[model samples]
Target: MGGLTQFGQGLILAAGLASSAVNTHAETAPIEAHAVFSPQIVSGSDALRHVAYELVLDNFYDSTGVLQLTGIDIFAAPSTKPLAHIGGSGLAAALPPGVELSADNSLSIKAGGHAVILIWLALPRDIAVPRVLSHRLEFKTQTGAVQTVDGVPVRIDTTPPIIIGPPVRGGLWFADEGPGNAQSHHWGGLIADNGQLTIPQRYAIDLFGLDAKGHAVAAPIDKLAQSRLTDWAGFDSEVLAVADGVVRDFQDGVPTHDPLAPQAPTNDLTPTSLYGNYVILEIAPNIFVHYAHLNTGSVAVKIGDRVKRGEILGHLGDTGQAGAPHLHIHLSNSVNFAGSEGLPFQIDAFNLVGRGTEGEALNAESDMHLSPGKGKPVHDAMPLNGDILEF
Candidate 1:
């Protein structure tokens, strides 16, 4: 695991520095360090492939210290062509402790005092095709105070990754545009082989538009099955307990943010911040399901609570880091979202509507059209809603 590797390296460095600093000060001074991975192949298709790598730095001394970053980059190349530089740069204070962070081209973080710098990259569809890609990362000290075992450099590599999962789940009712017929950005599709349906809403705002007063206003969008706009006050979006599992960890009162607004205003009310309400259910060994951007004071389950499939957990809302009101769901290997790996999953029995046709099955091997009424469903596929699914 990436966390294991990061911890091991951190431990070794801490030990090495202990002896050297013993005479200077009894109190452990924070060690400032940084790590940057060289770009490696991620996926290749049509003789061309995408590459990704990470740059991570930490201050081991202060639990909260500025995390200076450098050497952030990405490159792409064809088997028969020279490596073409895509784009990258050094990040200033890009990571903070206790937040979801990843090395595999998802998100980056930097810390400054008690605040953090978050950097997110959205991949365009042209470069997101399926293929095999490799990667490598390097570590360094900001003050030039640390070096590799051979006084050279520290780095790691991994085998190329096979991009086999669809970007989003298919089949489900979705509002394609914002209020007043606002334009919608087509994110991508979610695919499953079984008779299941997963509808991933890429634009949270598009799910429901906001009025000038920040209230959720339903748009004149097509509906799948018999689903309807749930009342905000009594809203309960039929949250299937996801899986027959126990609640391993949970936190409440995180305050929901307004999705209708662009960037979160500094003076926004705390209780209404984005990621307003959330839940994480542990369905099996090292597998947890996360649901974010729920309405505040809406969670009905708590830590260690036992729940079955199709149970009401909470209502959807505009919450943390969100552009608008929508549900954010994903499965991970660890309860700590930042330190976990994303796992592909499917939901059983939901109608596929929009763009092309109504009700069809989808899988990683299928190419779906983005036109209205063109989606499908998987008959026997299991839901990835934090449940341990079997293909």
Candidate 2:
């Protein structure tokens, strides 16, 4: 919800039905909600299609007490059956961390304040994707008044996903903190900059490489504290362009992180610090590809340089907000990081090789115990969370 607060100023003044109250006695509902993005059905490694997006809920009640959210249900438009439902503890969990809950453990929105609900709805196999989705929210006020709101619509984006080639090659790579993981930092990341809200990392993915023995590092686990930068398997590996494009924006000369002290120093942190020594390529009109956290001075192309597919852009390294050596890549609608919305793209081809332990990275345990095997061939699909692939 970092960048979401700015929406309040204009959204409160927006002229429309944010929520429609069902109780005949009540003319309108005080709580307003709408989907932030028109989501697309993404194919995940779990064999399920996912519709991932966020809902911005603004409480306009000028009363003294908070609005307690009781339940939430989503239905495919024109259908009576609910596609998903959450209530009680589940609804509470859907709210972002640090959101205050009432005494009954329900999400409570203070009067005139707003909250964001993260949604990752997975469609069952063989189910038809709906053209649009509608939401129904149930709430109770402090005075024990129960109310219902209906018909907040979210249209589905039906355009085919963008297809591109691998950004790295000749190794076993794992999609750490990738899509399909509900707890992934990339999934819930929101940026509020220049009075605008953007979801630049919604479809982003971080890649960590593995050796022939399936280890993420060249040194033993116990020696990580004493290891060198080269000890990380992916360090200095060539990062290639995923498609033909022009270099639109980039930054370099940011110092690399020390292996013995990986956590970034708290002082002087900025958006550029989050993606040290990165490059952006405009692959198409209004569509850009971002490759971040490369080694210092390794950026090979300058702004306005045209590049071809699979061209070497830089060597991956531990820089920016990265704790360990890995490549963070994603497609976006704008060149400015944290100022644009993330766009879903597909890998043209690869071989699924293994799976890493989810929600764990940059540590001895996560690197040493990857499950290894020859997996199936994947074509034009996103490599989901913890999925291992060979390119």
Candidate 3:
């Protein structure tokens, strides 16, 4: 797994820092891994043989469990090209698509901690095909044991959408990449309004703003409890069209609330609340883009209006189930926000600002900091957690 590495701003994981995970130590229970591939099918004739999946690894170690990840090897013994290879900037959700790795190819995991590996594999028809394809996962554990995961399978999804660049633009915005929003990993996950088996949020992410030094602030507030709608730089920021398409559906006029309100967000809602005064655009055949939490009276386009890439749509707001002023964007199989399969997408390109850490130290002046994801521009990659991007 050491060649042409493709990536996306994969889901940010809740794992220990690199140093902590690198120091390997084995405990009681072994590890458990489950791989779920999307598009559910692989067409050999297609040029873009890319397949994305989520690898769930549960560390069952009892003691001070720490597993040093030497490397992940994907092969079928004599195949010329491996089906998958890991490549990504070191960030929780930015792990290319599978495992998170430092620039030096080092990674680790804590005991009882689950490392979600994001895999985006490209298939060269010369080597593999649907169904009959046989593959193996040879992972090096910290304990010197080479774990072999056999019968790893891939489904051939006949139909899926082709994702394009980021929909909206301003200075910068950030959002959640996986599960919690897309997979309904949380209790408030988005399912279909009609009750369908969909991961509409699989490619969904939450949007926020950042400063020059990669710090986030709606607007300078007096105290933590004083967050105003205007305090959010993202508030009222213009959202754009990601593609030339027609507006299929939208809901506007939902009142936005002050994030700092003592009883802020004022309403009890769920993901089923129609993305909270949102807009859904049909950017592709059978594919729609959902832009939620929009400011009331801010929508610029209307139903059936044709929009071009970069065309202004509306401003960001704290409407619906939104607790603050930010944009909630995602791609889905259906026009509705609930129960549609999540679709992967990337910004045309953006400059890498840096990453945000779970326990990263913050400036005394604010409750946030500027760190992680600092480097070159990422092409076709989503904005992961702590990611400060400028497109």
Instruction: Give the candidate number with the greatest lDDT.
Output: 2
C-alpha lDDT score of every prediction, in listed order: 0.34, 0.72, 0.53
The true-versus-predicted C-alpha distance at residue 21 of model 3, in Å, is: 22
lDDT of 1 by residue, 1-391 (tens): 0000010000000001011111221222233333222222322111223222222234444443333222222222222221221112122212322333335322332333321222222223465332322211222334433222111122323433212222123223322221111011111122122342221221111222222122222322122212233422113343446677788765567665432344544433222332357777777777667666666777889888998766677766655655445555655555653224444343334433322110111111223333334324434232211111111
Candidate 2 lDDT over 96-164, as tens digits, reads 534545768677778988878767777656569889989888778778787667888999999877888
RMSD of every candidate to native, in Å, equals: 15.9, 6.9, 10.0
List the candidates ranked by lDDT, beginning with the highest.
Answer: 2, 3, 1
Judging by TM-score, tell me the better candidate of 2 and 3. Answer: 2
> What is the Å distance of residue 235 in model 2 from its true position?
1.0
Which 10 successive residues of model 2 have the least lDDT summed? 4-13
Worst 10 residues of 1 by lDDT: 1-10
Kindly report which residue stretches of model 3 are placed more than 4 angstroms away from their true locations once superposed. Answer: 1-51, 54-152, 156-163, 177-196, 218-223, 260-274, 358-375
Find the number of clashing residue pairs for candidate 2.
1
Better of 2 and 3 by lDDT: 2
Among these predictions, the greatest TM-score belongs to 2
| TM-score against truth, every candidate | 0.39, 0.84, 0.60
Runs with alpha carbons beyond 4 Å of true place in candidate 1: 1-172, 175-236, 254-259, 262-274, 355-375, 379-391
